[model samples]
Target: MTGLLPELSPGLVLAGAVTAAAASLWLLLPRSGESRAARWLGLALGAAALAGLVATGRRLGGLGEEAVFLTVALVAVISGAATIVTRSPVYSAIWFALSLTGVSGVLLVLGAQFLGVATIVVYAGAILVMFLFVLMLAQPSGLAPYDRVSNEPLLSAVAGAVLLGLLSLAIGRLTSDTACCAVAPRAAGPATQAAAPAPSAVDPLAADQVARLGGELFGRHLLAVEVAGVLLLVALIGAIAAVARGEAALEDDRRLAAGGGRR
Candidate 1:
C-alpha cells in the first residue's frame, strides 16, 4: 500500500485539478442573466488549465509531430470549450464546426489522410450545413431557452473529469509500457520460420489505399455501410418534414391575422 501511493498520487492530483477547472468553467459559463466578463474569464481559465494538463503529459514524439499535435490539440480544446460557453446558438454551432476541423487535422497528423478528408467532407461540409439549416429554421428569431442555460453543469463537470482522468491514466500507462518495452533488451532465440519479403511501395496491390479501403468496407462491413445510408435517408426525410411543419404554422398565423383584420 505504501509503495502504491507514489504511483497513484500523480493521477489523483490530475483528476482533482481537472475537476476543479471544469467545475469553475461550468459555473461561470454565460447563463441568460450572467455578465459577459465572467464568461470570458471562465473561457480563459479553462483554456489555461487544459494547456497545463496537456503539457504535464509530455507526450514523446519527434519535434514536427509534437508541434502538429499541440497545434491541433489547442484548436480542438479551445474551440470545444467555446462551443459550450458561447451565448449565441449560431456562434456555438460555428465553434463546434471549428472543433471538428481541428479533429480532422489531428486525424491527418496521425496518418489517416483518407479518414481526415472524409471527416472534413462529410462532417464539416455536409453534416454541419444540415445542422445550421435546422438551427436556423427552428429558431429564426433568436436563442432558444435550452440554449440560454446549461442543465446540470456540476454533474457534467464531474463526468468530464472522470473521463479525462481515465484517458490520462490510460495514455500514461501505455506510454510508460511502450518506453519500457522499447528500451528493454531482447533475448537471443532460434528462428522459427522464414521471414516474408516486405512489400514495395510502388506495388500495384499495395499502393492503392482507396481500393483497399473500399474492398474492406464493402467486403467486411457491408451491413454497417447499409445502416449508415438508411440513417442518412431518415434524417433527410425528418428535416424536410420539420421545415414543412414550420412553414404551415407560419401560413396559418398569417391567415388568422388577415381574417381578424377583415372582421
Candidate 2:
C-alpha cells in the first residue's frame, strides 16, 4: 500500500478520498425506494476512502505502530461515518461509542494517555445519560419508541452545549498554554530573554510516557484534577436529576393520554 501510494500526490489522494467519502455518505443514508446498486457503490466508495486515508496516515517509524494506527483509525472513521447515516438511533449510539473507543486508541498512540483515557470516561458517561434522557422522553403508549418522540428538547440542549463550548474556547484562548509547559523561562538566560524562541520550537522528549505524565498530573496538578472530577460528578448528578424529572412528567402525560388522570 505504501509503495502504491507514492505515485499519487498526497493532496490529490486526500481530495479523491474526501470526494469518495461524500458520495458514499449520500448513497448510504436512508432514502425512499432505494436501489441495490447504490448500496454496493456506496460500499465500494467507502472502502476506497478508507484505503486512501490509511495510506495518507502511514508515516510512523515502525510498521507495527503503523498497523496499529491503521486499525484504530479505520475503526474510528468507519464508525463515525456510520453514526451519522444510520437509520436507527440505537445503532447510531452503538456506532458512536465504538467511534469514541477508536478515537481514544488514536490519542493513546499519539502519546496523550491521560486525554485518551479521559475521552472514553467523559463520553461513556455522556452517552449513558443521553440514552436515559431519550428513553424517558419517548411516548410510552406502546409502539417503537426509537423515533417516536413527542418533541426534541435535546435540540435545545445541544444548542446550549455548543454555545457553552464556544464560550469555553474563548476563555481558553485568553490564557497562554505555554504556562503549563514551564520550559521557556528556565531554558532561556537573562541575556537571551530578548531573542528566546517560543516554547513550540523546542520539542520535549519523553523517556517514559505514561509514568511521567501520570506523576505530573497527580503529584503537581492533583488539586486541579480533583476539581475537574468534582465538576464531572456534579454534571452527572444534574443529568440524572433532569432524567428523573422528565420521567415523572412523561408518566403524567401517559396517564392523561390513557384517560386515567390523577387516579
Candidate 3:
C-alpha cells in the first residue's frame, strides 16, 4: 500500500483529496431538521476544502495578475459553493450574482476587458435583476419545499468530484505537454530555412478590439451570433409571459379569498 501510494501521481492525489473534502462537506451540510452545529461544521469543512483547492493551483503571470486572479477566483468559488448550499433562494441568487461579478473580475485580470464588461453588464446587472424579480414574484413569503431540501446531495458530490477529476487530468496533461513543447529541441525545416515574413505588431490593449471582434462575429460566425440573439429574445419573452401568468393567478386567488371572506 505504501509503495502503491508513492506511485500515485500528484494530480490523482489532489483529485482524491478534493473529492473526499467535497463529499465530507456535502455530508456535513445542514438538512431540513439538522442542528446549528452541523451547519457550522459544514461551513468549516467547506472553507478548508476551498483553501486546499486554491493552494493546489500553480500561480502564473505577473504578481499583480496572480494576486487579482487568486482574489477573484476565491470569491467566485466560495460564492458559487454558497449558492448551492444556501437554503434561501434569495440568498442563493445574491451569491450567484457575486460569483458572476468575481468571474468578470477574473476575466478583466486575464486581459479580456470587453468580455469582463459584458459579463458584468449582462449577468450581474441584467440577469441577476431578472432572477431576483422572478424569485420575489414567485415566492413573496420566501418559504418553499425545494429551497429547504437539497436533491441528492451524495449524488451531486460524486458527480462534481468526477467532473473535477476529469478537469484536473486535462489541465495536468495540457501543462505537461506545454512544458515539453517549450523545452524540446526543434528540428530545422524548410520553413525555418526560408526567410520568415515579419509578423505585424499590434498593441495588446488596442481600442479597435471591439471592431475586430464584431468583424469576426459577423464575418465567420454570423449564423451563431444571430442564433444566440434569437435565443436571448425568446428567453426574455418567456420570462415576461411567466411573470404575467403568475400575476394573473395571484389576482384570481385574491379575488376568490375576498369573496369567501364576504360569505
Better of 1 and 3 by TM-score: 3
TM-score of predicted structure 3? 0.73
Off by over 4 Å in 1: 1-9, 140-146, 178-208, 230-263
Residue 29 local lDDT, model 3? 43
Measure candidate 2: CA RMSD.
8.6
Residue-by-residue lDDT tens digits, candidate 1, 81-165: 7787777888988999899889989887766667878998998899889889988878757666777787777677778777887
State the local distance difference test value for candidate 3.
0.73
Model 3 / residue 253 / CA error / Å: 13
TM-scores for every candidate against the unseen true structure:
0.70, 0.60, 0.73
Runs in model 3 deviating more than 4 A are 1-9, 28-30, 140-142, 179-207, 233-263
lDDT of 2 by residue, 1-263 (tens): 55786788765676576566666766676655557898899889889877765655536667998789888888898898787667666677788889999999999887787788988988866765577578568636444544423233334434533564455345444433645644464635666655655543433323466787788889999999999999999998998999999999999998898886545
Between 1 and 3, whose lDDT is larger? Answer: 3
> Number of clashes in model 2?
0
Q: Give the lDDT of residue 34 in candidate 2.
A: 57
